[model samples]
Target: MAPVSHAADRVQSLDVYLNACKIGTIVRTPGDFNAFSLDPAYRATGGTPVLSLSLRAATGGLRRDPRPLAGALPAFFANLLPEEKLREAMEKHHAASVRPGNDFDLLAALGADLPGAVRVVPTEGARAVASAQAPQPPRLRFSLAGVQMKLSVMKNTGKGGGLTLPLEDGQGQYIAKFPSLTFPGVAENEYANLALAAALGMDVPARELVDKADFEGIPEEFDTLSDGKVLLVKRFDRGQGGRRRHIEDFAQVFGLYPSRKYDGAAYHDIAAALTMAVSPAAALDFVRRLALCAVTGNGDMHLKNWSLIYPEGDGPPALSPIYDMLSTVPYLPADGMALTLGGERSFKALTPSRWKAFANRARLPEPAVLAAVAATAARVNAEWWHLPERAAIPAAVLARIDRHITLMLPILAECGAG
Candidate 1:
């Protein structure tokens, strides 16, 4: 392995260490913030409480943490230390001898002491490991959180690479997402978008940006090493009242009920999942989401990016909230969406007739769905400018985003009319 870069070395030094012995044990009553006994032999080393970690179950057969060293810093960092003090410490610890291009062995070094079942392989040029199947030491570990809980990391394949993990905290579940490199002034764009969506009464997952350093015993990967930053988001699998449910991507949902498949064919469009809900009301909710995505200029919307949660019960399935909602048009160099809209990839091809046809094929009530779409578009347009101001996005970037939104506004308006 190449020498660890100054930035990676600093991150490694501050990463939290997880006690493998606690892999399948429940943390007893919280005591001393960080000191929680997962088992007699294993315990989490931290001065702050654990909000959550993403792990997978042994039975499900998912790859354990494919990149174990890429842990997010604990949220307690900001609360525990002053910003200037933390920055100074980081600067002092930065590895001055290491070069920028050196491949840092973060996961390998960190996982050396971990159990055999978990692997942490380091990627030569990338910040994160690709997969265990790749010709490298396993960089990630999928370990049981408790007897009944598991955790695993999910990467954001967006232009800005980020990390997210599904954490099952006893009967409660939440997703934790990390921050990624962005333009200097757009630091808090994700947080602002989430807050604004919440204000619009969207059922979004609970999210917060936290400092990783405050938490004691957290892995170094989670903290801000060098110039990189991280954020954490709670999973939506577990709901209030101790409800535990299975999370299925749109593809999985469609595959489960073949009868509801579109025209006896696999429904690859995410909109199909929203339209297939048994309740008309739920279908209408999806229409609102589609309009919101368009109005917000989230052009990267695709089937894989969305999911449907099937709670363990007889309740009807509902649409997951609008996530990955950054202004993709401005951020990405692509001219079209990841998935074709209205059977075409060209934005000009997304005509009102095509949308109406889509609604009809999805079995959605035209009037109700159109009304919801119009309402959501109006709300997003009205609130679009507020997000940049609140997030402190640079005026130049904000103007660029505004221009893209303006160009797409007419198309969004047409979708609402269908």
Candidate 2:
């Protein structure tokens, strides 16, 4: 790809790599928009690394011409940057490389350690193999999506197992999520919700709670915000010996920008995508998770929270392990789901008929969908009712969860769950 001269310091084009194989170039067009084009050889090759489902054509080949995206980077690349508070911190920390509100410079500054196996680099950089094991972390060179304040950290191998910042050259194995100043007991809420999901048979990632003191070399600003503890969640995208596995969220799968993550999509759209891109079984698992979220009062299951992982860095993607689940009722008393389910957003409106409607819209078997929902509701009822006191759930949050479950019972019974 040839670069067109726009400005002296502006980046004209970026080379995109997936699983360490060069696949395409994101070029700056004359209209001031950025567009991606797959490399001819990479597109023609068989069994190559997968970029994204949204970019793939019906013939199973990468599309030659995609609509140019507005702004400095395409939607896929823009979704890779940190959002809100974290984005501001990153811009200030790497001011020399990234200008405020500039997505291109931000990607160039920390391209090597993005969320999935994909990396976007200036065309002149050396080809990067994502699976190569580096001894140290990339030294605050990584960026994770979402508005929450978190850091990529590694758990120490010693007796105490303290969490430490990654030094250089590698991705952090865990994400350290601190408490929120505005929302009390946020970390504990998520921990309890995830625990309940796990008990109800969802494939959740390993997680634990750690004191702020347990973190070594954390930034000073986090100290002033939440309480003295944080939650440490293991990253599923990294496998044996820290090898990178490719993944893409629903936002990227639908080719939508992060700004529109909660809008323009419904639960049926998600189920449809799962059925088409992954499998019927994956879509059914989604129904179970959706029912569980409703029972637990989790109102934030947005597009970005759901993902698909390519285990072998190629085709046949599967639903990713659950992450970022929590009860929003404690914070928002009348909280509803992030996306509409069967023409409704209220958890209380998720009746048997609504689920049936969702199944019909998605072309899934109605009987299987209702069964998944009912089974999930029953499991949550059993698991939460018998949870030990040692779970340390905040009093108000636990009470709220119990109240929501009770509210779901009458409706759940109609769906064959009691």
Tens digits of per-residue lDDT for model 2, 1-418: 2222212145667788886789888876676677877888787873266677777777865666677876657677888888988888777666544668878667766777889788777687432233233222233678889888888888789897888876535579988888887777788878878888888778999998878888777755434356645888989988778788888999888888898888859889999999987899999999999998888888988999999999673468999999999888888998999998888999989998899889998889988998888888778777788776325677776787788889986676578753
Q: Given candidate 2, what's the lDDT at residue 378?
A: 77
Model 2: which ten-residue window has the lowest total lDDT?
Answer: 1-10
TM-scores for every candidate against the unseen true structure: 0.52, 0.90
* lDDT, residue 239, candidate 1: 45
Task: Give the Cα error of residue 253 in candidate 1, in Å.
Answer: 2.3
Candidate 1: count of backbone clashes, pairs at least 3 residues apart or interchain: 47
Q: What residue pairs clash in candidate 2, if any at all? A: 137-168
**Model 2 Cα RMSD, Å?**
5.3
The candidate scoring highest on TM-score is 2
lDDT of the structure predicted as candidate 2: 0.79
Off-target runs (Cα >4 Å) in candidate 1 are: 1-174, 182-187, 212-229, 239-243, 255-269, 347-349, 387-389, 394-396, 415-418
